[model samples]
Target: MDDYEAIRSGILETFERAVDAAGRDGAEATRRSLAEARDILAADRLRPVVLGEFKAGKSSLLNALLDDTGEPPLLPEAEEIATSVAASVSYGDQETIEILRDTDDGTPGLRVDRRGLREHGTEHGNPENRRGVLSVHIRTPSPLLRPGLTLVDTPGLGGPYLGHNAATLAALPGADAVMLVLDSSQPVLRSHLETVRRAASAVSATDTPGALFFVLTKTDLGGYGEVLADTRAKLAGALGRPAAEITVVPVSARAHRDFLAHGDEEDRAAGNLAGLTDALWAALCHRGVPRVLGGALDSLDRGVRALLAPLEGQTEALEDGTRRTVGELRRRALEHQARLAELRKGRAQRRVALRRRIDTVQEELRRDAEERHARIWDRFESHYLEEDAYLTDPQRLVAQLTADAAQVVGEINARAGTATAAVLVRTAAETGLAMGSSRPTEMAAPTSGDLVVRGRLGEKHRSGRLKRRLRDLSFGGSMGTTTGALIGSVVPGLGTAVGAAVGGLVGMAAGWASAGRDLRNEDRRLDRSSLRTQLQPLKRRQAAHISASVKDICEEFREQAEQEMEERIEQEREANQRLVAALKDTEDLTTATAGTRLAELRERTRPLQELRTRTAELEARTQAFTAAAVDRTAGGGAAGARKPEPVTVPGAAGDISWAEDRT
Candidate 1:
């Protein structure tokens, strides 16, 4: 067995033992922890979603990759937009189709015949998915899926149906990797580049590098060498990465299917199916598998810690030889209750302080945004007044302005996010709570559609008079908005403001000289004078919107931090209550009853010790496996450099000499 399989088996065995021990000893909390660990392990799969525009051959690629050559293909393909609902293909003992639907009552999955998939999954049959199909799950005994890798075929983006785009975008977050399929014949449009950027951002958000792959389909039709090269360049530019860093695989699913039927070597070579498979495997091994394993190990560690908590508590209680009266136990319980009250009061006071800190941070963000906008406006005015080229070329002027606006918004958002994170970190430190990694919301960059420039300008002309007058005139400055805020900042409800503010600036600049109107015309000399008058309203609106978003972001961070702190406090309160209850139960026990309780506690010693040992072993094995996976993924060593030792679970009745003898 591979390291993952071996380690997983060991972990499962340890969990089973923990569940049994917890059940026998009535450790409900530990049992719940084990159950959660099981659920995490069961749900862990390497999912690579296939995404593309409509009719880009996504379903065909999945079929070819899985080598589905039965009487009917596993995933149906048609001339029109076929897939309406996302379909996930995974490993199963037999071929089965489960139609997952959302009804007025509740979401339910119904097993359906293979023929019924078209009725639910295809656009022609479903017609904007009126059937309310959430997703379709297909299972087959395919070797490609046997490695715990699920392939998701999502509805194409930029289709006539808006639901298709939503469905495709919704599948992005859950994907470990994204295979962005593009048609070799079609030119890469702005929408396609937007999709690429979204996919890149999603993968980065998951912290999985080298997980996005570009697949250019339809190679069997004709020459697509240039198309492939151009697509690579565009994708690289969109991601702001080098062209060599992007992985593009050109394949013809039709050719691969033909090769499956004819067993021709040339057809197989032409298909390049094997190459794509290898690339995907390499990505999974290097990025996807390691991430999944790391998460599993972390979950297992938490479960083990939960199991250890109660065991340690019981050991401490049993080791205590103090003979206390009922009054003494009640007095101790009162102290715990007092402590709980103190914790509650501290929590309330901390919340008030957190709000104040958030308010301070929000105000600082507002000032920062205002200052940045002022600088940006200064730059814009300089560009407009100093550059003679901007006077003649309206498009270039708008482009430069939009680029500057995007950069400023990004910088402002980044600063706001950093400030908010600092507040959360400081709060957690004061409260002594463990804080998770803060994932700041990112705003997408503005696209061409977001900025609309109206009216046409006249031909290029170098007007010394216009430039001299513009330089002499005092130019007032205003901030503009981008379609989306910077990478780390931007909140909802700001998109319209972004488009209107930024697009309005471009529109005003483009229409300043009038359609086909000469800039040298003395009649339009005052047109340049009205630029500041027109920009004032847009600048005020943009400033207001940006400030509102910054406040919202700060509030969001504050609430998240407060919620985590409250949860941690509540957990401690519950644990203390449980301890008080146990003490009260002991307080009522007579001398004979107390002896019996001690005997029972001694009886639990063996099983708890066994559980503790098993859990430690499981953790050790998982750590070793994770380290090996990481090493292999990083090319630091060979896969066969070391072999994992077999894990042996000790029997319940095994000797516990290492455990302190309390008998």
Candidate 2:
């Protein structure tokens, strides 16, 4: 355990108590938030995945890390996808291997894997992972494992397993850290660099910093020094990070294995494996844990603030008394209601106009998306298909095509997101007119959820079978987008809260990337013409699906907007009635209970005030933990030219024995 993890553990314990107290106080929302906070902090593992091109020694690096005690490598290493299956190695009381496979009912089940992993999880047996093997869990006694660290071995990118690309990309955001392994003997290609950028971009979008590391593997092969320098230079040019801040380390997994087995200092010195191990442990202790803890703290703080709001509002209402007569208030309500009725009539006419205009917008969006596909495919044919070698090599063809397809989907999703926002802005203008306001402002600043809608779409599709019934779909009904759910409880006001709801619809229309998965490699030997001929049907089907889905989503948004308008009007009417009644009854109540309501409100808020104060203290601790972790990593105490110090585990009496890098 790192200091951050220890602090998080303390926070979790305190938050659990807070949940109990809140439940007792009947603060249901605060209790729910605190319970969620407990869940987030209960998991102790840091999942730092190893990702890269096929045959980059990713598995070997992970095996070396897992077998640090001179044990045999736990994972099978081969040059094919047959040995890759997104294996995660963690600590266990008893050594065990659990294979998580999807059942016929589509839910995952764990089966003991005593024989081998290849039969259930390899590409040859479960090709394209279509056999339903989700993940492999390996348990070991390595001291590194004692800190609750899980090393994930992802399938190689740009391999024959196209689905692996989607799976890996989807998993990137949840990773505590990512190690992008590269073959140091070769120059870093554009694709490899792009892989790093994508991972960094995803992490940064979530506001998590320093989650990416570059690993230059196969150092024993020689001539890697020049390659390492060049790769760093390119990364600096590409990512705009200070070269010093970007941690790129070199290692040889074979040499590390040799050193561990025989205690060969020469092998250890040559591989620098000890240095890599220390760096990894230090990062887990110093960077990963603090960042995660900080995020959780931010979430908890927001929940507490939300709880405090209503109490404060009620207290303030009691303090002020600009009471108006009940009759006057009722008249004002009727005037507002009449204006709302006129607005509704205007909205109905506008809806008809917008509905007609929507078809034109959809057609324009579809045309734009198809043109993007045409451009990408044109490039693919001109560059890749023109080469006889690309056609002959199945792996090469599959990898290139998979990359091209994902790129096209990503680009189209972006365009669709933009177009969807435009449709929404146009639709909202009518609502704005009804409310006697100017043009509506934009929704909450677009989260990564807005830009990468397909990521969420793919997650939703993978979680269940999305039936074709538009009304039955969550997006089609009232659930709104993922962005909407995040704000549904926190933000107040009709326009502000539901603006996020409308944004969710925009996300759904734009981010439907699950369709790209329909492209497969049943027969990988097809030439360019045959491939294009084969894909034409999928393209046509996908285009039609997009059109229908977008249509349904837009229709749903219109309904939600109308429903929101009505709900807002009703809320205003009801609130005014309550105010009128309160004013009419106030004279009698003041004689009997002056200041009584204010006293009760203050008493009710005492516990909440205490929780808020405690939350502030936890926030300070979270910041301190982050700052301390950053300082440790920055001073060459973690990873740099100097031999990295062994990261001390929290809650331990002394250091476990892998303190010095034998290198």
Candidate 3:
């Protein structure tokens, strides 16, 4: 849970929060997600997964750990998928992908084809020669499960069994806890080491990245010793270090049954396997799955905290707004009721009294709103802002709003002075317009072209989804960007209340100028927003200013929107504060005292119990993802690492106490 890990986790958590927000129906959902993300910063709940290629004996090793305790997973009797070659995990339900059907074998991945579990009666064997795809699940329940540990099961090294070899290879180095399986009987091949090298390059750490463990499987096979050297040499080559840099061990997993009977691995094959597991577990202590998950959790915590920090101060303000609005509404309603009651009391003058009362309130509404508009007029349509911004450049405002006449792409987000200026230029030659260029000040922007940056996945995004979104906001329609939504509820004549009022003044001047001398008697629509609002000229002008220019802003902001969005989100985080108030009243999350904080924290984490219970159930099932006999020596080049003996062999599945390594 060091700082760097914390940062990584936080960044990822933010992505999750953003995705959740994106899924919501309206901006309210976005706000809620932001709020949720803010709270999560204080409490982190993320598990860092330790994953790798299948036949890495990941299943058997986990089973051994499970067997160490009173609780052990029931490995499935059936088999599927030749070998996991995709990024595999014990749990995760969403973002579903199909298990690639095994062309080689009928069996692969999980099957839900049966109408019920009883469809096969008592038999539950795997489909044969399964390749590609495994299953999609959120979790599995293995007794050894805990919050700090997330164990993943992955596809094998070669391509076919699961899917692309690249997907599997790419996923390896990202693991905090890693173990490379080596077939003790087969020496490392040139192609094999190359794949491993590619996986290693993905890991990056400010200090040091993940550690590597070498497990030599199928020790009973004849090539264990010779292949071990090859495996070591290859890892050293990839890691740019000596053999000592890796942890190599030999194992024979088929001996589980034998060990159960004898309570020990007395045979050489069994002994080697036991020793391997022991050594691997020992070296794993420091870089255990727990530590990785802890780091992930810490990262989530920091992100949540940073996101929510702004709300702590603003909670009071939001509460005040809620209180004031509600109270005002109540008072007005009550007064209206009282007048009605008086009219009812005086029947003789009831009609007249009711009319008078209604008129009075209507007048008050008009007057109050009018007066408020006047008071805030300068803020929204301030001469200072317009003059300052215009002196800065009249073209800035239009650039932010419309499409550029010449150049199509433009900046969608306009700033405080409103949108950047768009020069709406016509070529001096074509329109004989004195404007510097023929380009429309506002350039068209890529609607969903690309706002891509490589984060966790190490994948590039050049898709069109979000680009279209921005494009729609810029050219096709109004109020599509996040900024637009935030201001949608704004009272046009009440501009001073939302963001800077300076832009309003510019619009007011424009409106006045457009109206000409008629402005004297013309309906003066102040550059202020009012409730029960009509589209005021002032509001339109301000919007116009912000979006006046687009080409100048370019696509720079879009590229950085993710970052800007995060910043603006926190900067204007005061939008909601009810939950934040609750936190502060409890002593700013630190608590009034230690005892109280502990209690509050427990209460806050009460929801976690449900999440944990769900995770536990998932852990159990995940452990059984793969529990069949694995021939670690099949692909490995090493002496002494045996081929997977048949169950019917004289001393095989039933009699052998072999602790085989399936690396």
Candidate 4:
């Protein structure tokens, strides 16, 4: 490889590295763009290659380069896959001059995916192949491409018509030479001259200066030279220069190769491939081949990548949003202190009702117990006599009294249970604890509290440990043996004191048994301290769980946002760099950027597009007015003049007549 080719390789390596370290979608796009730029750079480094259009002897030219004419020359005979867009190629065809023309005022546009040529069977004046695309590739054993020289074959200039030929002409920024192919039968048309001039201008302004020339095909037809001369003269008149500024050489590509080599006089032609190659080489050597297209290609790759970066970043952001991940986590702890305060108001009302119910129940129970006791006392009083008492077995008496007392206590307990449940239920109603289907719960654990003693009468009845002795009748021995001794030992006050002491002890034990049972039941009821113990673990567990989930959600959101942001920033950076490089490179390689041109174009088009729109509106209005004034079928008014250049694409960057609006 030459020094320039080596440099191209180095530049391509740099772009590869950029691709690897891109780190984001936009960056990746830029890197790939750079890769394509490598192709352009490589093209610049190569010897002049040609743009080969289809059905324009492209295949024959390509095959001849290696001097292999084995296959029958047929246009588009065995095409590859359907390539919808036009493609580029290199040819060493000397005699063929292919230049582009613009259909819109015969001017071309700057498109991206099109070449300025079409195949033989393709539509004429097709804009499908527009812009800076190369349309043909040819291989030739022609002497024209002997040294660092190449031939380019284009579709019929005006016929191919990728808009205007300006783009095809401008593409010379990467070329060292050009050839304009013409038909031997045609005249030197105005559009043809324009193509020659434009191509020359493009070459003059590029790395290689003035690398343009033309050729005429089908030379057998008469008047070819005369027409060429006439066109040259016309161009000189307009440009005020020698016609040699834009070279126009005529030849038949196959004349020598097919005519003399093959003895078929009618079929053989002129403009041999060998001769064509020699002519092309001459054109390129006229100016040293430019060796600077590498940079322009690289610049294009970078620019395309940059343009796509923002879109990639936005996609990343959208993905992050789907996960609901963000950053920063804080919990606002709001204590339900107000709800507790409200509870106090309810507690006060409940406390009053509870005390009243307790008093009423206690009074009622006391009255009922006293009245029953009195009835039992009256029966006992009637049964008692001076000598009626008798000794009985201890077991029999104990059993009888225990059974009667158990029955009566069981009855009382049943009544008390009903009364207590009713009172407690009422008290609970006044408290919010009992609201909305809620049940009053135990207030404390294990029902811990002192048993309250209230209005129950203390009754002392008699009895002692009797062994057929304490309640014994002393009628037999009462007179003789104990008259003097009884008087002395059983003094009245002493006997009474002993009996009363025994009765009091018995009453105390019985009272404790009954009261302890009721106290046990009440203690097993409501208790706040107990409820606290059960709820503590459950409430805490619930709160902790919810708090953790909230934290997890927030953490995920933050992480995703950060990831997307970083990716976006990286993409944006690469995009910006590519854009800057592209713009800079364009300015360096060309006359100027569209920056100033766009504004100038808009200024030029403003009046024309506006005028067109206004004319359209006015025309419609006049038609409507005429219709309204007509007596149902009156004749229309005089015909109107055509509207001035309405909605036209801008031309010359400032021509009002050329201004056009796309929308």
Where in model 1 is the C-alpha error above 4 Å?
1-10, 22-27, 44-46, 78-80, 98-111, 128-134, 146-149, 158-163, 184-191, 206-209, 218-231, 250-252, 255-278, 281-296, 306-345, 350-663
Write candidate 3's Cα lDDT for 239-347 as tens digits.
6765644556666654654575467636534635545433333323223322323222322333333333333323332343444543444454345445434533553
CA RMSD for every model?
A: 16.4, 24.1, 33.1, 50.4
Among residues 3 or more apart in sequence or in different chains, the pairs in candidate 1 whose N, CA or C atoms overlap within 3 Å are 410-486
Q: Model 4: how far is 92 from its true place, Å? A: 14
Error of 4 at 378 (Å): 99
Q: What is the C-alpha lDDT of each candidate?
A: 0.61, 0.56, 0.35, 0.36
Error of 2 at 306 (Å): 5.7
Q: Give the total clashing residue pairs for model 3.
A: 129
Candidate 2: tens digits of C-alpha lDDT, residues 1-663? 355446666667667656775576555644665676568666756878778887788877877766644323466566446433477888877677788776787657565553456566567656656666767887877766665678777778856555466556545655667778888877788778778777775455334335566788999998876787788888877777666666677888889888887889999887776567655644443346644454455445544544454455445555664343434544564565566567666766766766665566557756765675466467666765665556555344444444444444443343444354455446545453211111112111111111111111112233223443232344433444556656655666645457566756765554333222222221222345565654455445445554555455555544654554454344333433434444444434562373886687688678768866776676566555444444444564223322223432111011111121111
Tell me how many residue pairs clash in candidate 4: 61
Candidate 1 TM-score versus the reference: 0.55
What does the lDDT read for residue 221 in candidate 4?
48
Candidate 2: RMSD to truth:
24.1
TM-scores, in order shown? 0.55, 0.56, 0.35, 0.28
Model 3 vs. true fold: TM: 0.35
At residue 627, candidate 2 shows an lDDT of 46
Count of clashes, each model = 1, 1, 129, 61
Give the Å error, residue 158, model 3: 4.5
Candidate with the greatest TM-score versus the true structure: 2
| TM-score-better candidate, 3 vs 4 | 3
